[model samples]
Target: MSSRLLKICLIFIAFLFFSCSSSDDSTPSEPDRSYEDVKTDFQAIDFQTGVNDVSIRDINGVLRFFRVIIPEGDLSSNLRPLVMTLHGASGGNPDAHKNTGCFAEEGFAAINPIIISPNGGNLDWIEFANQVLVLSLFDLAINYLPVDDTKVVVNGYSNGGNGAWFYGETQPTVVTASIPMASSYNTFNTAGEARRIDVPMYVIHGENDELFPLQRTQNWVEATRSAGTEITLEVAPGLTHNEPCNYVDHVKNAAIWLENDVWD
Candidate 1:
């Protein structure tokens, strides 16, 4: 073959290989779990009607308390999603529950998720103790409850929102999506860390937030978007940092969006 023809053939072969590889990479695959595996892993625990406080020893041997809200139903009949809520600084399980329980009220009762809220022990959720405690609780919930692993969402408020970013970035496989509210990225390498996150993220912030401020959250969201992460931001008008209770409606909307748009 002529030298020019040989060069053209090699280039064409390389292009074909690259195109095929890119096409394969673009198609997403389902999670590696069978129906039998989910059924076998789920335990028959007496999940109470409302919220229950459960305690477990952390890696450092400190007793940590987490709240679980099992909606009124039988778990064996259906597979339900799980939502893990991380509380802000100085906040505990009750606070987390208060912030996220609206999921049950806002048209999610039929598909009620097992909500687990972890206490932040008055320290930032980024602290080692809190991080260990939260991750441990996740394992415990998955083993004990009939959780739909693919729909796990990690959500947080304020300082806990920071934790959401960390966990959602580091544990994308386990946490299917992240919802961070009234929070800003305080990590040393925000963009670098954000780049590692592959799950969908929904960020909600109060427009008039004094503590974290709306502009800061907007900057973080933009940076994360630049890193090629799928994220959505919802800014509540005239709301402040201390008024997270006002965010229940917004949270409901986010949950619906996740159900119809992201997860579906």
Candidate 2:
């Protein structure tokens, strides 16, 4: 070969060697096995501080907003109870916070999980995305909210009351007590498949509720209680669906229940 040809062939060989060596060195590594190898490591007592207006990405990668009510004073290893109150499908986050008094009251240390309310849309809490949003809020509270992880309470009114039942039945582990008011009866299509729920429930319904007849709400309470679940059914006489008893009786009942009950 000519000298020029010999030089070109040497350069081509060097390029080939470099490419092969680089490929070998940069082979894709085995993926991080930490997430897969270990089950979800949840230290429920890690953070003692409280955060509000927490915008967390849910299971569907949607950004949902939540307000957390943390216990007063230093959150020592001593676990304090956590109560989560969800507002009905008709109300906004601010309304939920206001109605439940979770932010106004300094006592409960509760979290109000808010799902947005649109003027015209499917008006049911069964929407899969909505449920996932609620679950994500629970996860955020469980992982971040400083409280007694074991004493989680779920409560709501109207659309929110139904949501309380749904969450109690679906995520039984996180729900130690349930408070539902002015709610109609509803069971998910996967009701039987739901994790067994023995969580104590408190039902608040108006005797004169014309919107959702009292019978239905009463039946819901009786059915759940007959299933051997601890429950307290309070019937407010001469009250409408949107009864003031939510603030007076329901909140009082919730306080009493939490003070006495212990969850497994």
Top candidate on lDDT is 1
Query: How many clashes would you count in candidate 2?
Result: 3
Off by over 4 Å in 2: 1-51, 57-62, 91-98, 102-123, 187-197, 244-246, 262-264
* Model number with the top TM-score: 1
Q: Please provide, for model 1 over 35-68, each residue's C-alpha lDDT reduced to its tens digit, 9 standing for 90 to 100.
A: 2332243233345778776544322334455677
The C-alpha TM-scores of every prediction are: 0.75, 0.65
TM-score of 2: 0.65
Clashing pairs in 2: 80-148, 88-160, 157-161
lDDT of each: 0.66, 0.52
> How many collisions per candidate?
0, 3
The sequence of per-residue lDDT tens digits that candidate 2 reaches over residues 47-132 is 23343333333222333445554545655565566666666665333334444443124324333222122111134555665654
